[model samples]
Each structure stands twice: as C-alpha cells, then as structure tokens.
Target: MNPTRSTFGLIFFTKKANENGECRIYSRITINGKSVDLSTKRIVDKILWNSAKGMARGTSKESLEVNDYLEQFRSGVVDAYQEAIIQQKPLTPENIRNAFLGQDEAAHPFQDLFNYHNEHEKQVLAKGTMKNYYTTQDYILQFLKKSKKPAEWDISQLSYKFIADFELFLRTFKKKDDPQPLNNNGVMKHLERFKKMINMAVTIEWLDKDPFVKHKLKFNSKERGYLSEEELALVETKELKTDKLMYVRDLFLFGCYTGLSYIDAINLTANNLMIGIDKEHWLITQRQKSAKPVKLPLLPVAAELITKHRHDPRAISNGTIFRPISNQKLNDYLKDLARECGIDKNFSFHLARHTFATTVTLANGVPIETVSKMLGHTKISTTQIYAKVVERKVSEDMQALRSKLSRKTVPDGEMIILK
Candidate 1:
C-alpha cells in the first residue's frame, strides 16, 4: 500500500531523565503532521543514547540490542500503517497506533479504569478510599446514561467537554437520602479521583494525551465546622430520646474524644487499646486513611464511652469497641440529634474529628504537635489549619478586653473623655 507520510516514525528518549541515570525510549508516529506517541516500554542508559541517530551509541551489547529494537519499532509502525490502508481506514496517526497495538477492534471501557486501579492499588489504598472510587465510577455510569453517551469509549475519546459535563452533572445530582446536591468541594473530589484513574491509564500507555491537562480543578476554601466545648458537652450530657440517636451520638462523641475518623473508629478493636507510659489506658492504633501510627491517652469521657459500649452485642460481633451506623444514616441521625440538643448547626460524623482537633484537644491545652500525631497528620502545616480556625476568643477574653478598653489611659499631651 502506497501512502504519503511525513516520517516513517521517530524513536526518541523521554524528556525526563531517569533518576536511576537511564532514559525510557518512546516512539512518535506522524502521518501528514498528525501524530500520536506510543511508549516502547523499553529503556537505555542516558550516557549511551545518541539523540541525533535516535539509537544507542557504541558496539556494546545493550547498544546493539537497543538499536535493533528501534529498527523493529519503525518497521512495526509502517506495517501498522499498511494494515490500516488495506482495511480501508483513513491514514491517521491514531489509526496507525491503534492498528499497531491491535486495539482498533477493541477499546478500554472508561468504567474498567476503576477496576484497573482497584486491582493495582488495593493493597496501597484504604478500603474507604476504594469505596469512594466505586461511587465515582457509579456516578460516571449515571453521567453517561443521563448524557446519552455510549458505555464504551476509546481512551482518546475522553475530552475537556466530557469532564465539564461530568462536573455539571455532579453539581445538579443529589443523593437519594440528601436534599442537597453535591457541594463544590465534593464535586472536585470526585473529579480528582477520576483524574487519578486517567493518569494511571496514561502511565500504562493506554492513552496518549491527558484530557485534564487543560482542565482546572477549582475547590472552594470553606471553614470546616466543629462543635464547641459547650456544644460537645451538650450532646454528651443530653439524654437522647431513642437508641438510634444515642448510638450515633456515642459514635460521634467517641470520634470527638479520640480524633479518630469514621473509618478508623469502626476499625478499632480490643487490640487497639494498650496501657501507655502514664499507666493510663490509651487508644493505640493507626489512622486507616494515612496509615500513620497513633497513640493517644484515652480521656475520661472516651474511656467511659468505651466501657459503656464494651458489652454491646453488635460491637462484640463486629470485633470492635464500637460500631457506627452507615455513614449517611449516621449523618442524618446527627442532624436530628443536633436539633434535639438545641444546637443550630447540622453535624456530620467527620466534623467529630474537627471538633477533636479544635475544641476537645487544642482548646484544652493540648500541644499542636501532639495533636498532629494523634490525628495522624504527616505535616505540622496540616494541623495548623485547625489551629487558625479554633474559637479561641471566648467570653472571658472578650470581657478582659472590655475591661482594658474601659480603663482608658490618658496620653501625656491629651486627655481622653469617656463617651
């Protein structure tokens, strides 16, 4: 088959030199200035590569083998192009690349990306994180159905418009139980997970270009809500009307006292408790999300809750000190409990950790570094966010300021009159 092409193919080294002092080899197929790149999944030494010849230099075994592979790669592109012409397909770089990879007849389902990531990162990612990914994939399926897009799309089919549409869908979509649609940061989070899987596809040579390269993720900076000491005390002391509300309140309180996230709280078992250096019972465990070690001395209130729930049949069955209800249901119960306790703000279980960081720990003279460790944060800067927002200007401090303002000191040159 005779076809006009700009260049048969160009074998090149990736721009980023390897930290191990090697460079990965890649190929660019161009047809009439339209091009697509395919990673060779091969490498050569940085010092031995000859950029001008697009081959490894010298008579060494590695150089000879690399050069031979380059020749085969160039021929492969030509053969792929010929096959496409015989199949009566237009001569485009993407068409040739798909033919070369034998992927022309097959395409990766965008849905399968979730499975691909789960299979590879199951050990590295937390189960809660994997669950979130599953939700994102489900949302993507819903997005496709709503937009009347095909279930199957080529990796190259992902585009800026697709991302924008997904964002809009997330904004307008509401969960079955919730009255509100996804918040701004919630939309950004789903998109972030989606981008992560896309990046993996690019890494494995499934896609040539990143669709999100031009897309900007804009997450709103909002103050994280937390219960104050009085509010926490109110929730703790107020007798709930029902067991359902009591269970959720206990779980929320446990999280508040321990700085344990919802996932971490559910994963806590009898083994997570240990006697610390102070000879007091401590909740010794690791943060599930970050896997950072945590050793916190159980406060009296936290210890009391553990003892109160120690004989809980469900807790025993689940092999944990406490078992919370489902996340959505838990948040719903918290909303009801907030109103029952005469608190104005709607509460979520996650805000329990925020309360722990700000009101329970930092407000009560707990050092920030120690709080960071208990929260399983890796950086001091991350913990500092809680510090900046804590309601430290209490009534007493305000009263003291008022007293100082009342006692006006007259300047040497002028007398100030009280209004």
Candidate 2:
C-alpha cells in the first residue's frame, strides 16, 4: 500500500571505482524518508551504466546479464517490503534490507534469547537463581545434542511437542558426573525457564506466537521437612568438641529463630537491625531470593547469637553480623551437629529456616498472615508450605481443650451434661 511513499533503486558507487575502473553496485532502499544501502556484490563499468534508468545502458551480453540481476534484486526488495507490511513488522529500511537478505528479525535463535534473558536477569536475580538458569541452559544444550538437533534453533520451532520431549529428556538423561536423572519438579523448573525465555521473546516481538500457550506446567507438591521444637532445642543445647561445629550450630540456631535462608543469614549486617513499632530489635532487610522486604522481630535466641558474634574479628572486618562461611562447609558441619545431637533426620542449613517458620513462629500461635509477612513471601500460599501444623502441636492444643472441658463438666441425675 502507498507505493510512492517507499522507493527502491540500484546505484553504482563510481566514487569508489577500482583501479580497473569498475564501480561497485548497491541497492538503495528508502522508507518514510529513512534509507539504507545494501551491497549487491556486483561491479559494472561506470561508462556503461545509466544513472536515469538505474540500469546498464547497452543490450550487450554482459549488460543484459547485469540488467537482469538488477531487475531481480529490485523486485526482491519490493517483495520483502510488502511482506514486512503484511506481517505487521516494523516498516524500516534496515528491516526491509534484512528481509531482502533472508535475515528476518523475528527469527531469533532459542539459545541467543536464553543467554540474553539470563544476562539481564543477573542484576535482579540472586546468585543461586542465576546458577539455576545456567544449569537449565546446559541441560537444554545437552538435550539438543542428544536429540541430533542443531545447537541453535529458531524460537518459532518451539512447540508443545518440543516441550514434552524436553521434559522426557530431562527425566531420562543422565550426566557423566551425576548419573541420577532429574526428578519431576526438577524437570519442571527447566521447562519453566524455557517458557519464560519464550515469553520474553514474545514481549520483544521476536515471536509472533507463544509455543507455551497450550502447554500446562504441572508440579507435585511435596511436604517440606523442618526440625521439630525438641530437635531444634537439642541442637541448640548440645555441646560440640570443635570450635567449627560450635560456629555452625550457632548459625543454624539463628536461622531457626529468624527464618533467614542460607544466603540471607550469611549476608546479615548490623545495619539490618532496627527498632520496630514494638520497641523491639528487628531484622529488617530484603530477602535475596525474592527481593521482598522482611521485618522479623529478633527473638531472644537469634538476638543472643548476633550479640555473641558482634565482636568477632571476621564479623567486625566484614561489617556483617556473622562471619560468612562456605555453604558446603556449613551443610557438612550441620550434618555433624545433627548426628552429635542425636537428631536422625537429614539435616541441611535450609531446615533451620523451616524450623523457624513451623516450630518457632506458627506453632507458637503467630498468625499465618504475620508469618508470611515476616518470611518475606509474596503470597500466603508459599508460607503455608512451611507453616504446616505438626501433629504434636495439634495434640497439645486438643489436650488443653480436653482438660478444660473435663474440669467444667458436671454430672446430672439423668444425663451427664457439660456446661
């Protein structure tokens, strides 16, 4: 539509003529007064070219061939311009040139888009999150190689079938370093990352249709395990031989009271401690994982641990409340601490956060809404996973009601009614 508004012509750049006096050919494309010159990779004698007709002057054999090529090139550019308009792509001279050269901007490769999304997300996402995306990317590359597909595939090639096949690959594929395949939720995470990258492509107009539109992500909800109150108390009071075990125990107990994850716990600083509305010292900081603000009032045990480490040389130098330890070392020491304390459960640093949410907060009658807010959860449903009511708490509550009822009830003459 509106043919005169856009123009295409073949031109010879005689100013850059070679020593043999041959001028290079170029295709000029103009759209809405913006223009781009694309090389035709052809050369012609300037004397034989017609500036007015934008072609060769003579009908000689060489001239005929050059003229035919120019006609075809011009027609191709016109077709590319019309096709771009039909596809609702941006009407620019560079885009038309790209279309003419068979390089459509919409056809971005999946790997390229995935890398770009990860690079930009690093600013906002935590290190652990960025590592997860890297793992997902590696898995995708391995999947492509095993499936005998190209390393780089067009994003448009993604489909529901492609997603299903990827999930199957993740479930069945075994790595050389780790023979165990990914479980259901592990596979789901990679697929979710893939879908997110595709969604970004759609937002940037690189994809016309979302392949994940028909695919539904399903994940199994497994109960998150946390240390019970008795086990946590056992760990807290258990004396250990080495100073390292003692340090790990202190870190674990602090998490049990504050509900801070491993990363947040290590990064905590004196600056994060502030007086809240209750006139109590609180840990006010943003969670590394979700970047949500958390306002947790420091319980006695957590505050005591902070005070104990306040004058530590490493803590003082780092300006953090606790000296940072390697996560692997922390977990390893936690295992030792757990066994020495006679707790049979598989122990990890994250369990301490679960303990805080379940045994320390929710079990003590803290409202779920308040727990969710202090845990820095964007949704209450996330808090519910950690706040599951343990059977002991239920029994204790029901036993209290039983005792109260038995004390208030009286035996009547005909019926033993309670008041």
Candidate 3:
C-alpha cells in the first residue's frame, strides 16, 4: 500500500500473513516514504501503529496527533544519534552553546588544551615547572573572572589586542591584601607559558593560528654586575675566620680560579681531577646547565688553590665535594665579606662566576672561545661580552704599528733607500 500524504505522519502496512489457521498481521511504519519496523508490545507502540494505519487509510485528527508525537520523537532520536556519531567532530557554535547552557560534557572549551599540557609536562618537566604552570593558570582564571568570560573560553579568542590589554591589566591589578603593582616579569613569565600552551594547541590542530606569532616578548633583564679582580682580592685578603665564612670564601675563590659554576663546583671533588697525558691536572666534568661534558686544563693557580684547600674530611662527603652551605647563607656571608673589604657592590655567590668569566680569563689574555668553554656557555655570543676587554689589545697593536710606520728611515745616520 502507498504511504500517507502527511509529511510528519507515520504509515503502517502488512509485511506478510502467517500460514496459521488465523491470518497473521505484519506491521511496518512508513514516515515520508521511509519504513521503520514497529513492535506492537506497548500501548504507546499500538497507538502509534493504529494512527499510522489510520493515516494509510485516510488522515484523521487522532492520526495527526500521533504524527505530531512521531515527528517530535523522531527529531529527538536523530539528534541523539547525530551527537553519538559525530562525537569526534569539531564542535559547532550551536553545539557548544547548547552544552554550555545545558551544562553538558561539551561545555568546557579549554578542556582539551588543559588535558594535553597536564600529560605533556607532568612527565618530562620538574616539580618546579608544574608549580609555575598552576601559578600561570591562576592569573588566567583571575582575568577570566574579571572579564565575565567562561573559564573554558575558546583558546583562539586570546587575540593580540586581548593579550596586550591583559598585560596592561596585570600591571595595575592588585591582590586583596596588597596595593602594589603586579610584577611585570611574573606576568610576562606566565604569558610566555600561554605561548607554549597554544603551541601545543597548534600541534594538536585545535587552534588554526598562533596569537603570539608577532608579539614581541619582553625578556627579564639580567643582573650583569660582577666583582672585579681587585675587589675579589680585597674580599680574599681581608681576614674572616668563622669556619662557614672560610668555606664560602674558599668555594668562591675556587670558582673564580677554575671558572666552575656554583653547582658544578659543588659537585667537583678528588674524583673529577685527573692527571692527563701532558702530566697536568685536568677536570673532566659535565656542565650542570647543558649537561655537556668538558675537559678543562686546570691552571697552575687553580691547582694551587685546590691543594691549599683539599676537601677536608669534615666538609667532604659521599655527596657534593665542596663545603655545602645554603645559597641564602652563602650570599649573606659574601655580603658581609664585601662590606668588610669596603666593596660597595652587591655580593652574590654567582658574582664569583662572573669574576671568573670576565677578570680571571679575559684579563689574562685567554681567548674568549677558550673562556666560553671553561664558563660552559653553549653560545659564542654569550662569551662575546668579554670581547670589550680586548679593545685595549687593539689599541696597543695600533700604537705599535704607528711606531713602526713613523720610525726614521735613517739608521746610524745613513739614509735607507726604499726597495
């Protein structure tokens, strides 16, 4: 039989009659010419079947009601099916809004970005890195709250203007307890993390574009002030006798001599030193920063310092070789040492590293390339700052050239002829 004319109505027809003494009725539903098998178990099913059958015969008021109900039910099923089938597809605006308003699983926009970073960083990075990530997120949440935006706002909505404005917003916004400017570097540091977060988004194809592509990142300025040789001499020669103070001094001087960074020097001991084929003391150690192994020829001065303070049984242990002191306490003692020596500059333990890089190496005419290796700088440009000290060498060479060019042509009162 032909289906009903109504667009939304269901039509039912017999499938086949059984071979029993009573003819068996077969029921099938047709809606808009498409067939659906109908089960006659429930009252709702029976009513729907009867309405479809009635419509097939002639459209009735009751059949129209059934058609309306069928249309609604069919729509609900189709929607549920679409959601199930297209679960992996990129979300449309309507889908996201429905999820947000309906408080469904699709509500969280940043969920993917968050999950990705959590897995990526949780394994490879350190505890400190994880801590920083949360801190950065805290600021982001604060910004979202102030802007009345969803916590899971679209990652792509982070436009250039939005980010620049947020930076300005951070500069003025104060915490409840304090009325002070937010640390600019702290803000930038966190925002830098956002760049990384979005980079991951780009990799996963979540974001079509990068927001940080053209943005110029402001780098935190380095504290470049370092102690001079005379200042170091004053710190060393001035008498200071507390066991801890003495240890700090010796450690600082050792760094200055060997160009070992604080952590590298901390790890060095009798084991790191080896007598090489040239019969000179050499240090074979891996740099703490880059983990690159380096073979350094120890200077006579470095050897002398080591011999003078050969790791005492009290100080040396199975762990680090140098006398261990907290960075805070070491810096404090160095500050006091600096004051006693009448040196006005701030005296951090790292200045010892700077002193080595600048005064000890450059002043002694050791090539910057060699100094860079000793200082364990991964880039030559990093070592080029000391190139400024070599300007005097250029001046001296020019002076010698000038002297040669101006030398009198006559020697022993005899005129010299040009060749």
Candidate 4:
C-alpha cells in the first residue's frame, strides 16, 4: 500500500448558504477513495469558488481571502498525512482529517521550534553562532508580543503576509539603549536564522509548507572598509601611554595580519602554531565562524608579534597567545588609538579582518584563493568582496595596460575604432 497517495478538493456547501447568498466552503480529503469532509469556516459567494480548480474564481477581496484560506487548509492536510504515517497510525481519511483539524492529541500546531533548535543544534554549532540564534529568538518573541493578536502568531496562522509583517517589525524595532533599529543586513540575518529553524520543523513533519519558501533574502551590497598600508603601519608602530590601549592595538593588528575574527583571534592557544609544509611556522586552527580548517604560513610581522608576546606572564598562564578581553572595551580603546594615529574609519576591532583581506594581502598581489584559505572562508565569493574594494588593484591593472599601449596617445576627441 502506497501510504503517500492522497487527493484533496474544495467545494461550496450550497445547502448551508446564508440569507446573504454566501455559502460555506468545505475541504474534501481522500485517501484511497475513502473521503472525509471538513468545514473550512470560510464563507464565500455561491458562484465564486471554482470546484474544478480547487480555488476561488475571481479578483474580489472575499474571493482572494477564500483562496488564501484554502491554501493554508491544504498545507495543514499535507502536514496531517505526514504525521499520520510517522506515528504508524492507520492511513484513513478520517485520521488525516482529525490531525488537520487538531482533533488528534498527537498533533501540535504551535510547537516551539526555536526552543528545539537551541536544545538540539547547540551541540554542533559554535558558541558564537548559537548566541546569534538566541538573539533571533528574542527578536521573534518581541515581534509576537507586539502583534497583540493571540491567534496571529500561531504556526497555523503564519503566511507570506505574516513574514512581511515580521520583517517590517524588525526594521523599525528599537530596543532600550539602541539608538537605531536594525539595518538591512541585520534584518536579513535574523530572517535567515529563523528560516533555518523553520526548516527543522518541516523536516520533522511539523510544518508541511515553509512560509519562507516564497521569500528570498536580499542583503544590500556595501563596500567593506579596510585600513591602507600606511594606516596599518602607523597603528602597529604607534606608542601608546596606556598599557590597555597598547594591548587593544596589538590584538587588532594580530587580526589584520592573520584574518581571524575577534572570537577566533582571542581563543587561539599556543598549540595552534605548528611547522608547515615549508618547514616554517604556520597558524593552524579552525575558524569558529565557518569551522573551516585554517592553515596559513605566518607572515613576518605576525610571527614577530607572536615572538614579542611569547614571554608575557598572562600569555604563559592562560595558555593563549593573547588573553580574552571584552569586545566593547577593545572597540572603545581602538577608537582612541585610531584618533591618536591620525587614521580614521569605523575603527572597530573586527575591521582588522577586512584589513587583512585588502591592504595586507590582496593589495600586495597575494592570490585570492590563498587569502580565502587563510581567512577560513567556506566560499571564495566572500573573499572577493575585499578584492572588489581594492582600488589599488584596479589602478595597477590600468597602469599595466597604459604601459602596453605606450606607442601612441589618442588625439583629444578623436574617435578610435576596434579592429
């Protein structure tokens, strides 16, 4: 017996038509020709529903509303069919209908899938990534609470419209101590994480249809900021009066040379360094972000910094090259350091990774594939963002072309044709 085989239809209950000539629409679910009728509780005009197409016929508001309800009803029925098979229940039309209608005690329409992810996926996911997921969950709770409709946030009531509303809410939501709401990419990230959790539900047969299926995540392209070669040298060599400022500057410079994010850089222990294929020193660690293995030969400057701190009491005691520091405090010191050095941009600690990809590597003619590996990127496309922003690379290419075409200069306003 093919338990997966099933058919569904919609019909207008003309006999239940009210005085206004509007009839109730009912769902007909069939399993091996054994059928069951369930009331949809949606009223529509007598002639609006197209029985053959299993949908409403026209563009009127009532017809559109009826069509949306019918689609959700069908999705729930599909969910019911999967649930029935999973629990080894008898594959009867009535059993499926009961599950769809919440008459089955086993069916849970609003299972907390976000909570499920935290409990299960946390084991495999990095601690930093798990923290981001928790942030997404908190934002979702805020969205649901602000909706003020008890029924609206339920799993069964979710639709494309609901997704749109949630995105809007995230964009405009400003929590305490936050000066502004989430920017475009910030909003997209929350939705992307939420989509992953929703996918878990679909896999477990909790949701038959994904609301995010029709939604495409769009992140606006912004040119990443990186320090120039001169700026990096200035920051690296600057003498700070305070030990804390000096400490933050060195940590930031280490990231610039190695392309490790803030978390990966601080968590690095002495064991991460090893002899490479060339029999020279290399940094060997997996990126906490992508969990990709990073095996990059140490640059001279990076190796020098490691040697400079090799004998520090804190480094020896902690077994880490650099002890952990608060990200906020580091960024705070970095702002002062950048001002003192007369170099300016958004001087956050994470800017060091961008600096490594641009001025320290690509601008110096390093291969992009090699740079991608050093950075522990899963995709080369991510590293290409840095390459595009390297204006020096574009200028160098143009300069090489200028040298090749040195024979003659085109006269002013003279038209040149390609042969």
Assess each prediction's global lDDT (C-alpha) against the native.
Answer: 0.82, 0.82, 0.63, 0.79
Stretches > 4 Å off in candidate 1: 1-11, 104-106, 122-127, 144-149, 172-181, 386-388, 393-419
lDDT per residue (tens digit) for residues 1-419 in model 3: 12123232223333323353222122233334443333221122232344344322226665466556545544543454246335743233333223322434323366557777988878766554677887777777787778888877866455688788778777878888988876768778877887898788766645545778888778666545666667777776878868767777777787777777766776677888998889988998988666767678887767777776665664465444565666668789888777767888877767777777767777667788888887777888877753335345566678788567657543554554679
Clashing pairs in 4: none
Q: What are the per-residue Cα lDDT tens digits for candidate 4 across 315-345?
A: 7788788866877788888899889898868
Model 4 earns a TM-score of 0.73
Clash pairs detected, candidate 3: none
TM-score (C-alpha, index-matched) for candidate 3: 0.61
TM-score-wise, the better of 3 and 4 is: 4
Lowest summed lDDT window (length 10), candidate 2: 6-15
Give the alpha carbon lDDT tens digit for every residue of 44-91 in model 2.
988887777778888898899998988888888889878987787877
- Among these predicted structures, which one has the highest TM-score? 1
Error of 4 at 329 (Å): 2.6
When 2 and 3 are scored with TM-score, the better candidate is 2
Show model 4 residue runs off by greater than 4 Å.
1-111, 151-153, 408-419
Pairs clashing within candidate 1: none
Ranking according to lDDT, highest score first: 1, 2, 4, 3
Worst 10 residues of 1 by lDDT: 1-10
lDDT of 4 at 253: 88
For model 2 the local lDDT of residue 61 reads 89
